[model samples]
Target: MRYACPTPGCPTTAPTRTTRCEQCTRRNSRAHKITLVCGPPCSGKNTWVAKHAQPGDLIVDLDALYTAVNANPTRTDHDQPAALTPFAFDARDAITNRLLHGDHNLRAAWIIHSAPEAATRAEWKQRGANIVMITADQDTLTHRAQVQRPNQWGEHIQDWHRRYTLGHVDRTVTTG
Candidate 1:
């Protein structure tokens, strides 16, 4: 059973954290139906998913999963999994794969993203996934970031704006 790296932009796969390649995590496979929720941080991706996702609808938000399993849910740490540190992304990716394949009587899935490259979005679109993007001006992003995260939300917003250039998408929401 080969697993995939859930971390964005890192496609290298490994067996497990113990024996898997030092690149990405690995786990069971299912087909992949992913709805890419594209937006900047603090742009209401989590809020939108919370409002939209019904029960039994698979949600693949990495930070939320990490928070669910960790004492400090808000801790934004990735890649370096220490002995007993938080490393729930493996589980997230595995479950996401299952959801995409519609395993165990699954239905739709929501995947929150931070401005995926156009090619990446196109790949998912080809796999029969939907894309939802929440966008706003830089000022709005900065204000929302201050209200939501305050520490680095502004930087993340800038990053998203700089990275987002995809032309074709299923839906676009202009958030203010």
Candidate 2:
């Protein structure tokens, strides 16, 4: 009898005594819907996910993860120390690997990241992820950064703009 693969989004059937199908073992298929939200620091990627994501859906945001792992209680989003960046990224990578190749009960996952390269976007596409690009005018981004983010965020915005390439994203959202 062919049994369904234990991996979350994999569709192949597994043989007897196997925990996952051969394809799944090779990490060939995605087990669920993965939406990759890409944008500058203050572009409302988190807001967009908050508005669209439903209950039980997995939402992975670096800032949120940083806050969760941060030692300080007074630190807010985007104010995390540089020392915590690696930990936050490691956590994100682990969760992303699980989403791509492991078992889970969630139906969908929303990943908030500032992916500014075409290669990164293409990699996500190959892994069966839908990419969404969030953007705002320079003035709007600057203004939002000044009000909502630290002074260094202006540099982040500029860096995103400098590196961002308009790739084959599934959706484009403009937020002021």
TM-score winner among the candidates? 2
For candidate 2, the C-alpha RMSD (Å) to the true structure equals 5.3
Residue 104 in candidate 1, Cα distance off native in Å: 3.4
Residue-level lDDT tens digits of model 1 in 1-176? 65554444456664653343442222122223357887777677777888888888777876666556766545654312243233566776677566544445555578886654787677666556788877677787788767656476566667767776756688888877
C-alpha positional error of residue 93 in candidate 1 after TM-score superposition, expressed in Å: 1.9
What candidate 1 gets wrong by more than 4 Å, as runs, is: 1-34, 73-86
TM-score of 1: 0.68
Per residue, candidate 2 scores C-alpha lDDT tens digits across 1-176 of 88888756667788864587886665544443788999888888999999999999999999899888888877755887888889999999999988876466677899998999888987887777889998888999899889888789999998988897767888899997
For residue 133, model 1's alpha carbon misses the true position, in angstroms, by 1.1
For each candidate in the order shown, give its overall lDDT on alpha carbons. Answer: 0.64, 0.84
- Lowest-scoring 10 consecutive residues by lDDT in candidate 2? 23-32
Model 1 root-mean-square deviation: 9.9
